[model samples]
Target: MIDVHMDPQVLAGLQEVMEGEYPRLLDTFLHDSEERVKALRTARGDTQALRQIAHSFKGSSGNLGAVRLALLCQRLEMASAGDIGGLVDQIDREFAVVRAMYEGELRRVFVG
Candidate 1:
């Protein structure tokens, strides 16, 4: 049962590959992603800025196995001045979910 929100295999690979730093990596990605999501809000309605923010956010999200959110950002990256507000709202919502998921993983695996 793969969640559309993320890829468990990718997350597992990152955990294995990163060794002890996996927690920190998730922490950094979450922090950086929060800023990017906020930037998307602030830059809404500006096609150029939205594309740039979405592009970077897409890369980071993909790297972290945020499958669905990465796809949302990809859509935003290619947006053509159509429903920018709606797309930003979608990205904002997705990021919130991703952050919570990662935070939960941190607490359960790292803290327990």
Candidate 2:
């Protein structure tokens, strides 16, 4: 409902993509988001893989309309050089909220 990161064009594109296999899109988002979160959980913020993970999540989430989570991912990416332990928990929580909301809406639109 809140198209924070997704503009009308993006939403339209998403709708077109989901015209047939909507469940697949939802599954992909869930799986990829989980992987990104797991990467953040284990990342020590010094490795290039960690930075890549954050950047990937930021771009992916933004494309999927999870603006807040994408922003957090950007922050994590930017702050990857520092001790991100404390921010990890916060990011996880926020990501979860966005994930849930996005899933709920996705279901409503696609599965309803």
Candidate 3:
């Protein structure tokens, strides 16, 4: 099983600074992540496209403290000479786990 954890310190800092915009920030990250995952799934055998997508996804996920997701993206980005399909599948599965965690966090913060 993959472990999913968001950085509490990063989240607390965002909440401190973002204030009312915190929910929106969460929503945006979730939405953008969905799009990036789709792009990764549809990248086929295009290494350039896959690398570009993974690099961008890595930076944003790291910014939001999704450390595991960012690390997965980093692996995908560096796998220009290996099995791209396998990495994409791994990313898809892992993103599902990460997405669930983020959604739960959003509810805890916004709905509770």
Which candidate's lDDT is highest?
A: 1
Model 2: weakest 10-residue lDDT segment is 1-10
lDDT of each: 0.88, 0.72, 0.85
Per-residue lDDT over 28-66 for candidate 3, one digit per residue giving the tens place of the 0 to 100 score: 999999999999988867899999999999999998988
**Winner of 2 and 3 under lDDT:** 3
Cα RMSD (Å) per model?
A: 2.1, 3.5, 1.9
Models ranked on lDDT: 1, 3, 2
How far is 93's C-alpha from truth in model 1 (Å)?
Answer: 0.6
Q: lDDT at 81 for candidate 2?
A: 57
Per candidate, the number of residue pairs that clash is 0, 0, 0
Top-scoring candidate (TM-score): 1
Q: Local error of candidate 1 at 107, Å? A: 1.2
Please write out the lDDT profile of model 1 over residues 65-95, one tens digit for every residue: 9998999989888877877788899889888
Q: List the residue pairs that clash in candidate 3.
A: none
Q: Which regions of candidate 1 deviate over 4 angstroms?
A: 1-3
Model 2 compared with the native: what TM-score? 0.77
- Give the higher-lDDT candidate: 1 or 2: 1
